[model samples]
Target: MDKKRIILNIVVVCLILFSLYILQNLLMPKYVSAIVEGSLIEEYYNEKADYNHDIIFIGDCEVYESFSPISLWKNYGITSYIRGSAQQLIWQSYYLLEETLKYETPEIVVFNVLAMQYNEPQKEAYNRLTLDGMRMSASKIRAVKASMMEDERLIDYIFPILRYHSRWNELTSEDFKYVFKKDKLFHNGYYMRVDVKPVTSIPRGRKLANYQFGDTAYLYLDKITKLCKDNGIELVLVKVPSIYPVWYDQWEQQIEDYASKNDLLYINFLELIDEVGIDYSKDTYDAGLHMNLTGAEKLSLYLGDVLTKTYDLTDKRTNKEYQEIWQEKIDFYEQMKAQQYYELEKYGYLKSFGAKAPED
Candidate 1:
């Protein structure tokens, strides 16, 4: 080929690659400014590799909102990270666990059973929350396939611009501002809410014709179990103590049976609300749906014992390096807590936690 033709082709290829990169960045949701749950999955990549976590939490909002890694470190000297997002389905959890194994392997993998309720892909928003932050790999490809709805297309996930090109009309200053950067909104993937929304009423679960979990949900749970066993990671299944959702006895039996059959440890926090010291009147932020920072700390304190005794996790807080790292996290945790309390006192609601300020 002629030199001029070769040079032109090279420029064209470079331009195409660069354009796609920018388009992908632009089309992607900027979770930094709002709905920070979407940012939780991607933020785990920023963790320093020097400190190997002893435990890893994976599931949906229940996992993220219920467990506090900072509290775990403070109370049990256990280093941990939570890879959670809103409505993260079982297949998505399996794929996320598959992707996480590529990095550091924790001694135990905690899978919140709330996600098991969803057998099939539930919503595109939830799928994006769990998948958008994942780095491209075979696991991500598999996860996209497993979690996509009937209307979803694989190519749109691969080339996000195709899916999000319509967002051009809704682009705001925050979109362009955080195109390449975002505010760190979570502490080790725990989304904190310090304000209190006391449980006023408990909702009863509607009777299900089939109390059994779907086959697809069981299939993914089996995959998650095998992945953990293969990686030499113990799987701990837990049902966080949320007051309302009304975790039925039938569902409990299924999980208990699965745990017994698999020989895995399963703890239903709902059964231990008194033991965990979770006072819904003071602990939860959104009625009985999710726990606030206080509830998370209480739950973490309870789990710390199980993790240390059952799993034999060594206390890393005594290490000088870990002490220094956790101190910073502690400082941030306190700062957020104080800020939330202050906002609650002043405004009667959390204006600074996950929501953007009105001035912005």
Candidate 2:
């Protein structure tokens, strides 16, 4: 009788645990449909184990939207991945680099400088978009603690069900369809857009009381630099040719000075616009905030030249195994581009192509 009682108790506990798991999966945002950028961080984990990319990009929308890893591969044979999120902060980038080093140390770590403008946590929504997808680890825990706003809680992250359980009322078929799995959303962490939206007007950056990056921002940057140095990874600082949230002259001087002092390479794409053959008239998707496919390819071509020339990085184009892997990537990249173009031709505007940055 006692053995039977013990077996019954075990069955009951297993049932409860299984139910909790289902509920949690159902309540969490699937990010397979609208607002798809949230899936970017999580998709990194899905990359095949052999993705020992030579370069890794860390920052926000700028890096992901500006450069195409496919373009880099096709042109320069550089294997790279962009670990970016919308409005990703400096500390977030630092912790991502830390986590990435644990998995594989790349030859170069490219960090977008736009995030340096933000000194403190900005919003919970942005925080969730970035952190929610990160697999649990010491780096993720530290990232959450460093990134949480005043009203946010670490427990909420540990058990997303606590925060998202209320979403039961908002659940849809997509929630269930993607609860256990998500549609592959990005190619090598690169978001693709074939449609072109001309840059009509760019609001100028407001004059700031101070142009110097905050202490906390610099502190983490120092950590990032040191971390790379300790791991023998070259850290490259880049400013994408985004016209808004102005990359001020003061800010440029500071980054230039920092790079010079640290012996780091800093590329300000804004200055290389004409050289890169970027036409603001059509190369941008939303005004000058982000690049469309045309602009991204142009920038990638120019940057690829610089990276290969400077680093003397191997051209994996001739490599048999890399050819097999990137051929798959190329096929997927072409498929997505063709799909976006078809969507534009049929609908006259992109309907389900991920996200557009909110007005600043």
Which candidate should be chosen as best, given lDDT against the real structure? Answer: 2
**How far off is residue 159 in model 2, in Å?**
0.5
Candidate 2, 185-253: lDDT as tens digits: 887777787777677777877878999899999999999999999999989999999888788999899
lDDT of 1 by residue, 308-337 (tens): 888778888789998988898899889888
Clashing pairs in 2: none
Candidate 2's error at 317, in angstroms? 1.5
Candidate 2: regions farther than 4 A off: 1-4, 354-360
For every candidate, C-alpha RMSD to the true structure in Å? 2.3, 2.3
What does the lDDT come to for candidate 2? 0.89
- Lowest summed lDDT over 10 consecutive residues: which window, candidate 2? 351-360
Q: Each model's C-alpha lDDT? A: 0.88, 0.89
Question: What are the TM-scores, per candidate, against the unseen true structure?
Answer: 0.95, 0.96
